[model samples]
Target: MLPLPESLRPSAERLFADRLGLAERFASMLAEQGPERGLIGPREVERLWGRHILNCALMADAIDPSARTLADIGSGAGLPGVVLAIARPDLTVTLVETMQRRATWLEEVDAELGLGLEVVRARAEDLHGVRSFDVVTARAVAALDKLARWTFPLVADGGELLAMKGGSAAEEVDKAGKALAKLGGIDPRIEQYGVGEVEVPTTVVQVRRRAQGTRKGETRG
Candidate 1:
């Protein structure tokens, strides 16, 4: 098992609080099984705490306190999905992955952690029109334009898509402008979390779905 660095201990405690042990166990599972299962690269094991776990845990801060449902698309290794569920027990999280092996691993983690996650083995596009959630998120999935096409429809009216991104966040958002406009996404913005806690803060591109009856390009009053 990869050891949680002391440097990250305070951030972990701040994010997971009483659930820190569960986070530790999940980290152990990932460190032990992730590379062998192809869920994460072998190189990732060394920085699992900073680069993966805590990086994901901090996104919990961006989530709306009133949001009750969330879905993580392409939730391979359950980055923010499992991490969010562990952090906010109040949320009903669904992990959506098309790959059989990754979905199976998610199920195993859910069962092991008793997180009550709904693991769906289907592509994010498949759920369009069939299901929606208060918040939809994805990490390391695809570039912003294509990702918005797949995930924005899953965002319920007035809800948001909180996509984890990298330095290219602004570039991606600019590139996705047309797609966002057509998809009824409004006020797209980039935000960072865990500043001062981690060596690098997590960058997120947040886009809210226009509420029902709101026309595209119409400002909210």
Candidate 2:
């Protein structure tokens, strides 16, 4: 049994209790196989509970209760994608990774965890016209500007892109303005999120897609 930070324990218990022993199983896999397979760094094993798993699981708090499907772009090692599925079984998650090896690892982890998430081996841009999602999630993937270009097209009308970022989250949002405008993204703002499970709050930049027929840089005249 891995020890969780005292403040985070209760929340973890609540999140996992009804779901079975998911937390434990996920921790074990990450610690044992994650490093060996190069899915995570050797130094990351000790921090998996706090930095990786719990952090990603907290993303569930940002998801809309009515959201049915979520796409995790650049889902290397399934970060938030796998964790979110375990935390919220009601969500249909798709893990999109351009690397075959990473995609394979996602599939393996999904089967092992029985997460029921779909693993798609393609970059976000490739899937733009083929699929759309109610929510798009990304973490440590790219700068907000480039990320917006790749992800905004995949968001269903009225859907949102929730990107996990570090302390520079606000700055990223500011810099992504022009890119967002070009991509038809609206309301790009930084949101403080988390379940009180970690010492620092989770920072996310949320950008919503404009509803159909609404044009960016246009006014009803």
Candidate 3:
């Protein structure tokens, strides 16, 4: 295989050392799919490592290692979903995408990479599977409230929902608290981190489903 492009070596080395190889694979996959999906246009290939892969990886770090089943909504270009599956082979990921073509691309990537995963060509409302995942993650999808409504039900009674966001995650986290509570997830915690010269602004709106069901630090409201 060709050497990793010079531009991405720094980011790739960092991510790889962190054991986040999925980040690298997802960037390469986007480069491959650009011809067909048009999501990562030609101009994007060089920057995919830092902009896309690193951006998506921010969520993978927040996910507890204990999480088993992950449902990623609006998995366009398969952000953290595809990254998570590749990074953590032990974790089963169900990527939910409304667009048929994107889902097809995801399936193709999974098959080509031999990444064990499932892609569902369905929208949040159309999904009939109930409370079935250990974690639900949405990246740049709908607004926080809507994402809560869309993803929470897919989380099992003791699972959690995490919405990855930018800007003052504090404000957005507060705005979505009520919605989260109603869906069986507890209030969220704001996570902050940075990489290189770029400030990786991220907000994780995480709600614990329940605990019987309750893990320590997770309480029923």
lDDT of every model, 2 decimals: 0.94, 0.83, 0.72
- Angstrom error of the Cα, residue 173, model 1: value is 0.5
User: Which candidate has the top score in lDDT?
Assistant: 1
Give per-residue CA lDDT, model 2, range 63-162, as digits (tens): 8888999999989877888888888899999999999888898888888878888999888999978899999999999999889989999999878899
Model 3, TM vs. native: 0.82
RMSD of each: 1.1, 2.7, 3.5
Best by TM-score: 1
Report the C-alpha lDDT of model 1 over 178-204, residue by residue, as the tens digit.
999899999999999998889989999
Name model 1 segments beyond 4 Å from true: 218-221
TM-score of each: 0.97, 0.92, 0.82
lDDT of 1 at 104: 95
Backbone clashes in model 2, listed as residue pairs? none
Supply the TM-score for candidate 1: 0.97
In the predicted model 3, the residue pairs found to clash are 210-213, 211-214
Worst 10 residues of 2 by lDDT: 212-221
Candidate 2 positional error at 6, Å: 4.8
